[model samples]
Target: MTTDPLSATFAALADPTRRAMLARLAEGEATVNELAEPFSISLQAISRHVKVLEQAGLITRSRDAQRRPCTLRLAPLDDAVDWLEEHRQVLEGRLDRLEVHLRTIQQKNQEHDQ
Candidate 1:
């Protein structure tokens, strides 16, 4: 387990099965068997994937009588998304500056052609 929440979230998302599980959970909470039904893997495998998601803080499992329903946890995901958006804004700003510089060069070229 990484000390960084973002890194842990990314790591958890890196697995396709886990990503699919998250998507399924997004619709609503599901039992382990429900989450495992879409894939050919064993229930144990799904349980392992669920454990990783739980560790990453992406999902929470609560007991409802005999069922342990897994619900999606949005806080870590929101934080990850916020982090990505921050970097995206920084890149967009750089691209905006580049666009301005290119426009200036184009204007200079037009003047020279004239």
Candidate 2:
């Protein structure tokens, strides 16, 4: 079944290897071989990770001569950040209201004791 862009992005990012590959691409474009260099996994594995990133719209691959270099795409990351920031604001608001209620209850208890 097809997934939403945010779901697909999160799924791809759930893998540490794919996240690292994205980090590398952030620095600059890189071939699968270059991405594989730092890891002990085979080139095939790195290529698979690259494919996941590409499918998630997190990266793009282009052919330059015989090399296929992958470049990072920031749109998906920006989407994720926007979603997180929205939810963080909601949670913070909820916490602020709860804190106020607790303080009011504490003051009531103190008055009753006095």
Best by TM-score: 2
Over 4 Å off, model 1: none
For model 1, how does the per-residue alpha-carbon lDDT over 24-65 read when each residue is reduced to its tens digit? 999999999999999999989999999999998999999999
Best by lDDT: 1
Clash pairs, model 2 backbone = none
Worst 10 residues of 1 by lDDT: 1-10
Q: List the pairs of residues colliding in candidate 1.
A: none
Per-residue CA lDDT of candidate 2, range 5-41, in tens?
Answer: 9998999999999988888888999998989999998
What is the lDDT, from 0 to 100, of the residue 37 in candidate 2? Answer: 93
Model 2 residue 17 CA deviation (Å) reads: 1.5
**TM per candidate:** 0.87, 0.93
